[model samples]
Target: MIGVSGTLVRGGTSKCWLFDITDVHGRGASLEDVLLAAFGSQDHSQIDGVGGATSTTSKAAIISHSYESGVDIDYTFAQVGVGVNEVEWGSNCGNCGTAVGLYAVQSGLVRPRGEQTTVRMRNTNTGSRIDAVVDTPGGRFTPSGNATIPGVASPGVAVGLEFLDPVGSTTDALLPSGAAVDDFTLSEGAAHATLVDAGAPAALFDAEALGLTGAETVAEFGAALPSLLGLRHRAGVHMGLAAPGGPVSHAVPKFGVVGAPRDYTATDGTRIAAADYDISVRMASMHAPHPAIGLTSTVAVAAAATVQGSTVHAHAKARDGEIRLGTPAGVVSARLVLDGERLTGVRLNRSARVIARADIFVPRAERVPVALP
Candidate 1:
């Protein structure tokens, strides 16, 4: 058996298995095999591994102390397929981004400079930089605080993150099609969608256009997965996210719908007032409605809201300052700094906690090699 030591951290609404880069062996096909074994990717339930059998829980973060001047750490986010036997490294995870600083400080990868330490992180996946600030009283990372985000049960240390130059993280353009709103015809019907690449590539549509009220429960949305995915696959081709006439199963560019804010019940059965938010958004990860808001999607939503003719912009009110977006879990806000026609940066705060630390043992049989091009 091969043992890999790592920590499991709950960052924002997702959990990730964090590993130091130097400790992980192999590359390319070999690395993929190792990860599949570590997470038990061939099984739907992931019962043989640490994965929680869901997209949110089947994530990994590979971190290394940065040698680049001005950057403190380099992070590469990986989306490990549950039963598909694939590992996609195309985009970064904003939820896991919040935990990078905590792991760095606690693991001595970075030393706190003052009461609060700001770690400049370089996302190797997208070549984007994010400034993550964590509260470090007396030069130590603190995980206890009053910071609370939707989906998370309790308060934890506040991690302020600013995604700098968030545009075009995955694709070559912010508006991949050179238009804010594009029309696509699917088997269901015609739909208007916005393809934005802020922090991550995402396709956004008006819920009404998709025959959704934007307040559907998780189960209701799951029942509509076929239609939703059909729209997503077409949008993916339109935005060059996927090859034309090819099968689409990759996690991104993400798919979501936006609507005018309305009163709705959260996943935890708590009522959310529409008056508190500017718009409502429901996003899908791996073809299912996300239990909570995704950090990268929040950035894309903020960017879409600022652009004219987009669905989010049409329903958005009180444009300046923070934009509160109501999701199935609750509301998550993003503050956008606009410079005329360009978006300068996006800022938001999330909480994270170290859940467990242990050695993941991979059997020799699971590490068998596969042919690669």
Candidate 2:
């Protein structure tokens, strides 16, 4: 058996296996094979592995002490396919990024400074730098707090995440297609969409254009997966996020449907009044409705909302400041800083905690050849 030491962390709305770079044995295909074994890929239920069998839970974060000046740690996010043996590293997970600072301090990868510690992280996937501030009392990490975030039942330590210069993460420009609004051609008709790249690339569409109310339950969204995926692929091609006629399975340029806020009941049976939020959004993860909105997508949504003529902009009530977005799980808000038409930065709060520390074992037959560092 091959043993790897790691920690299971719940960051924001996603759970991930966090590993040190030295503990990982391989690279490229070999690395993917190891991850597949560890996460029990090619199985719908992930019954044989540590994975939770869901897109949000089947994630991995590889970290290393950064050699770059001013950066505390380097993080790489991986999306492990639940029913397939594939690991996509095309995009960074803002939820996972929220926990990197705590991981660094806990594992001694970086020393904490005073009562509050700030760790500068460089996301290897997109080469974006994020400043994560975690509360440390007497140079020790603190995991207790009353701050709460949607999708998480209990409150934990509040981690402040600032996505600095968060534009064009995956593409060449903020608007990769050079248009705030573009025509996304579908089989039945065409719809107006906005392809924005802030922390991550995303394709946003007005819910009405797609015959959606933007307040769909997870099951209801799953029922429409085929058509939604088709629209995502078409938007990917139009935004140059995917090559013409190519597969859109890399998971970059996520797809989301947006609508003006309205009174509706959430999946949790909680009433969400229209006046409580600025807009309503529904995003997809691994072809399924995301229980909660993604942190990176939140930045993309805020950026798009600030841009005039974009799909999100039409539904958004205000041009800037705190934008509260209602999702299937609950409400999430982000503070947007815009300089004219340019998005300067985005700030948000997330809670993270170390759930467990254990060794992840891979069977001898499942182990791949270890690459020399």
Candidate 3:
């Protein structure tokens, strides 16, 4: 039996259970079966496992001691959708990165000191250095504070997440195809799209092209899931981001609608009035729904909104350099540093809490092949 210690944490808009890959056994089961057991199959209640039902709560991360100097740990992400059998490992979840640093410190892997502790993590998926800062009171991570972000319902200790060299996370180039935008000819007609690979590969399209106000609620889109998923699948192929009809397991090359803020009702029935944000966004996770948005999508949304020719730019306000976006939950604020046409850096804020850490026990009866159907 292999025993592993794990921590279930909430970071930004997502929650994840973190484990060390070295401690876990059985990579034998197909990703689908593994995810089903990990997240509790057919159970949105997650009565038999740790999954929180919503995509935000259906994530997991594997962390290991880093061999590289100046980096504390290596992070790998796993997206386990509610009913899906597979776990998507194609991209990194920045929200999950927040918990990793704290987990490292709490587990005695790294020493935490002063009020602020900075931990550097190497994202194995993207080969990016993510810097995380936590406020420690009395030499431990403390969540009792007035710190707050717009999206989360309650305020907790604030953790600042900075993605270093995010300009080419998924692909070697910010504009992977060497063009600011790609001209894709759908069955209907040809439409211009932007392909940005920073943090994650993302395909950008105007809201109007899909008959969306860019201000629609989550329900409105859910009602059109068939078409929406089809659009995403087609766009994935169009961008040359994925193979023609290949598995849509890769969450990169995310599809989203960008439009200037207009008065709209949020998923929570709150009014996301035009005055609240400059742009509106709805991002998918593993081709499933997300209660809120993820960090990578937030970066893509901000980058597209700031660019001059994208559809989002039309409704964007001429403000300071940073771009603020409104989502189903609330506003997600981020920054994009532009070095002429090249993207230099991306930054954002997130929250994380350490739930628990203890050895995960694997019974001897399971010592045989961890079988899956």
Candidate 4:
């Protein structure tokens, strides 16, 4: 057995376990083998390990100090599949980046610079740069704080992330298809999709085109999971996320539906009015609906809104780089800094807390497959 210690941190709306690079790979084991075993990917319920089983919870990242100029930390995000026994390393997680920022300074990877310490992170998975401004009072780290996010009830330390140069995070262009609006031929029929590569590659279709309001609850999104995955596959191919007639990723080219803002009941039973938010979105995180909007997807939504004919742009109400997205949990706000046609950065307020520190044990290196490419 291989025993490795990891930190469990709740960043933004999701939870991810952070591990030091050396601890997981000093034995020369494959990243997927270690992470899959650590998260108990073989079991759907993850009863044998620390994985929370849900898409948002079953996540892990390897952290290390970066020697790269202008970057303080580098991390590789792994979306460890539940029951599926797969680990997807093709995308970046904004929520995970939030956790890594706090983890970096808290663990002394980066020296805290009083008041607001900036931890510049590069997600090696997608090559996206995120400036995580952590709240370090008097140059000291605090484990918890009064800052709260939309989905989580508990408050934590505030970390504002500025996604620097987020355009074409995975692909090479903001509009990967070279157009703001691209028509994707779905199995049922043709659907017009706005495929934006900012933050992460995301393909958004008008919710009405899919026979539902974008403000639908998580369960509603789950009910249409099959159709959503199908759309994601096609979008991935269109965005060059995958080769045509090739194995498409179920993760990237984030699939979702967008709609005009309207009245809806939140998961917490709160009433949200049309005027309260700019647009509505129901995004699928892997196999199910993301209970709360992923910040990276929020970045994509904000980027798409800037386009003239994008689906998100067509439904959004807010202007001047302020985007308020209505999710299942509540509304998430993203601020875009623009210089003429150039998008300087995207800033978002998030809360993160160190949930637990644990020693995880997994099967020996030779016992797990190292065949994943």
Top-lDDT structure, candidate number:
4
Give the clashing pairs for model 2: none
lDDT of 4 by residue, 142-174 (tens): 999999989999999999999998897677789
Candidates in order have lDDT scores of 0.85, 0.84, 0.71, 0.89
When superposed on Cα atoms, how far off is each prediction in RMSD? 3.6, 4.1, 3.7, 3.4
Give the higher-lDDT candidate: 1 or 2: 1
Rank all candidate structures by their TM-score, best first, as comma-separated numbers: 4, 1, 2, 3
lDDT of 1 by residue, 1-373 (tens): 7888889988888889999986676633366677888898889999888888999999999999889999999999999989868898877898889888778877888888888888899999889899888878887877577788889888877888899999987776889999989998766678898899898889998889888877778877778767678778888888887799987656678888889989999999999998989988888888778887788889999988878889889887866767999988888889987787789899998888888888988755535667998
What lDDT, from 0 to 1, does candidate 1 have?
0.85
Per-residue C-alpha lDDT of model 3 across residues 1-373, encoded as one tens digit per residue: 3344567776766677887765454655443455457566456576666678776788888888899988988988887756555577788888889878767777777788887888889988778888888777777756444566655666666788887777666667666667666665667766556777667778766666666766667777565455667666666776566788785555767777677788777666777778867887766666554556778777776666656766667677766768878787777778776677666767887776766655544323333555698
Q: What tens digits encode model 2's per-residue C-alpha lDDT throughout 1-373?
A: 6787889888898888998988876633366777788888868888878899998999999999889999989999999888887899988898899877778778887788987789899999999889888878787877676668887888877888989889887776889889999987677787888999998889988888788877777777667667777778878887787788998755777888899988878877898899999888999887788888889999999888877789888888883488998898888989987777677889998888888998988654434668999
Q: Which segments of model 2 are wrong by more than 4 Å?
A: 26-29, 187-189, 365-373
Q: Which lDDT value does model 3 have at 362?
A: 31
Q: Is candidate 1 or candidate 3 better by TM-score?
A: 1
lDDT of 2: 0.84
Q: After superposition, how far is residue 167 of candidate 1 from its true place, in Å?
A: 0.6
C-alpha lDDT of residue 83 in model 3: 57
Off by over 4 Å in 4: 185-189, 365-373
Where's the lowest-lDDT run of ten residues in candidate 4?
Answer: 363-372
